[model samples]
Target chain A: MSGLIKSSLARKVVMALSGLFLVVFLTQHFVINFTSVIAPETFNEWSHFMGYNPLVQFVLQPILIGGVVIHFIMGFVLEIQNKKARGIGYAKYNGGANAPWTSRNMIITGAVVLAFLGLHFYDFWVHEMDYKYVSGLAEDPTRYHEETVEKFAPFWRTVIYVISFVLLSMHLWHGFNSSFQTMGVNNKYSPAIKTITKLFSVIIPLGFIFIALYHHLNPITH
Target chain B: MKLFLKIWRQANANSKGKFTEYTLDGIEGDMSFLEMLDILNEDLIAKSEEPVEFDHDCREGICGMCSLQINGEPHGPDRGVTTCQLHMRRFSDGDTIVIEPFRAKAFPVIKDLIVDRSAFDRIQQAGGYVSVNTSGNTIDANAIPIEKENADNAFNAAACIGCGACVAACKNASAMLFTSAKVSQYALLPQGQVEATDRVMSMVKQMDLEGFGNCTNTGACEVECPKGISLENIARMNREYYAASIKG
Candidate 1:
């Protein structure tokens, strides 16, 4: 296991598992929010109901957070290890147009996504969870419904979300495919996986962007 | 052509290193980059001084031994060529050239510009090589008719000489490009598929243990690399790695 631990294959495995887990989380989160555009009232109720779900509130949130932590930690750790194995600069002779921006910028995009997570929690989760708990509205999340609207209502916040989601798209573009490869799944399924990776890279971020823009443009009146 | 060279000088890895200034006069502009260094060394030897210690073998550029940070850029400023391939004609007369050893935690200075690139070899040993030994011929070489595309890509991927310039040119010093190239070579070839997962996982792990920084995707590595290895190989490795993780 130690020998395996020291191998690149294992490190990639860690990256893939963690990354795919987060992708699943992102899709679920997106699907839940798509309800808002269908009908604002339903969206609000759904959001409120999601907050009150006992299993998700207690058991799942920790797991979701843990996924984020592990995905990011393993990525950076593997990157550092790769650097040490090479040198300050990699050999230029063999490298060509083969390198894409995202593969090189995984850390940058990941860092961007990480920072976005902080803002994300500060805006949505803080109000949806932390403030709800502090204001004695834990039993009723709708009391803080205005908080959710007010946060997304800011044009700048919406812009930040768009840019961050763009970064997230870039991250996911490389990460989605990379996750599959890292997990040793690059067989006949590679083509299908690559296609899905590209599609999700665009679709998921677009989903988030649409939600943010709709909220900002149509500022929900309390 | 006349030029000012701020070359790094050190007796050995344990000794203190510093930049020493030297001016060369009447050097032919057509001289290769290494020839310019040779001229400088000749001048120093005449003065009874130690010549700068840098790595070079088969200066024709196939050996992958020559490496230097010329004016803060690896292999000088020329794209798609090694330091040995660079010509003095690229520099104007009286230009100030700053020379430094390749800066990488994994590539510590052995003497002056010579770096210990043995880490790359160790990584290859971790799983870069084909598992099948060259004992009694395992059937004929053509027993397996690998697809032309895969064969070509494998050849392209195998072009990596293990020079450490990508690490130096990269902002974070990540070696994903190099490790990926090695992994993709085997991943693309049928002969390498048997050890593909193990090769990529082990090599990448060894790379991480070496104390280098993470990849930040500035494209500097791609831009400065002499052989022009594609960033696509990195993606291939990522894909290969993803598959390996699930199997394990």
Candidate 2:
């Protein structure tokens, strides 16, 4: 096990697996968020169940957090290793000659995504925690829709969410197909995978941005 | 044609290196890239200056002995050809060419335009070969019937000449293409079945231990490879490595 973790290929397999895990999490989160516009009661009910369930809060949430931490840390670890591998760079390196901008700037896009995650956690997760553990208003599940609308009501906050989603799109554009390649899934079906990944990368982030915009443009009247 | 050249100059592995500029005129379009360099060296020799040191043996693409990064592209702008095979016609008149040795932490500059690529040799030495019985009762290689596709794939993988261009072209200086080529070559063959698991594990371990970077799937190494080695080999190697880990 130790030997496997130490190998470069094995380490990459870890990154790919963790990345795929995050993608699934993102899809679930996006679907839940999208439900607020289509079916408010169902969205609120699902939110209530997730928030109040001890299994989800204690077991799954912690694992999700661990997954995020692992994915983020692995990105940094790989970036640092890659930088050190090239001791001295070419005086005139035309990286664009061979690779796409998103592929080459994965570390940069990843940093952008990380910063956005910080804002996301502060906006939703921290507020939930404070309401329950700190402020002692834990029993209120009725205000779930109102609270979500209120969060998106601020113009600057909406703008930030939109921009973050755009950056996330860029990050995923390279990441989705890259994870597949890393897992050694290249074959006749790979072109189809790349096409689907490209579509998902664009559409999912666009969906998130649309949800934020919908809430911002039509805040619930009290 | 006249060309301005900026060639990397280093005294040794530990010494500092920088690009030294030279001007060459009356270069013909028919001259190979290495031949142009030969003319420059001959001129330097007449002036009693040390000729720029670079590696080349066959002056053909087969040996993979010739290694140089010409104008930010490994083996020059043209694809699928080594430096020795690249012609002067690839560049227009008055073009400035930057020549440098393959740069990587694992491939330290030994001198002008020359890097010590024995790191590749070490990785190969780790587990690149199948341990075959040389006793009198050895089975004939032809008897073990391999599928046509696997046999072709093995032959393709075996085409790699251990040139360090893949390392030079990779943004992370990853040697995945080179290492994978070796791994896939043996892994696809029947003789290599006995040690497939151990070979993949040890080769990848040695690759990481040698200070090479991780593969990011940018596909630069495959694009820059002189032999046009496919990115599929890297995928195959990854699959083999994952299988080895799962079994253990």
The digit string of per-residue lDDT tens for model 1 on B1-248 reads: 88998888777878877778889887787898898889889988999988888898889877788999887788887888899999988999889888877778877788888988787888788998886766876666578899998988888888887787787776566677788788888898788888887887788778877766555444577777788876667768766665675687
How many angstroms is residue B213 displaced in model 2 relative to the true structure, after the best TM-score fit?
0.5
Docking class of 1: incorrect
Best candidate, TM-score-wise?
A: 2
Backbone clashes counted, model 1: 62
Error of 2 at B110 (Å): 0.4
Residue ranges of candidate 2 with Cα displaced over 4 Å: B133-139
- In the range B1-248, model 2's lDDT, one tens digit per residue, is 99999999988888888889999999999999999999999999999999999999998799999998888888888888999999998889999999988889999888888888998999899999988777887888889999999999999999999998899999999999999999999999989989899888888888988899999998888888988889999999988988888888
Best by lDDT: 2
Off by over 4 Å in 1: A1-9, A20-38, A58-60, A75-116, A130-145, A152-222, B25-29, B125-140, B171-223, B231-248
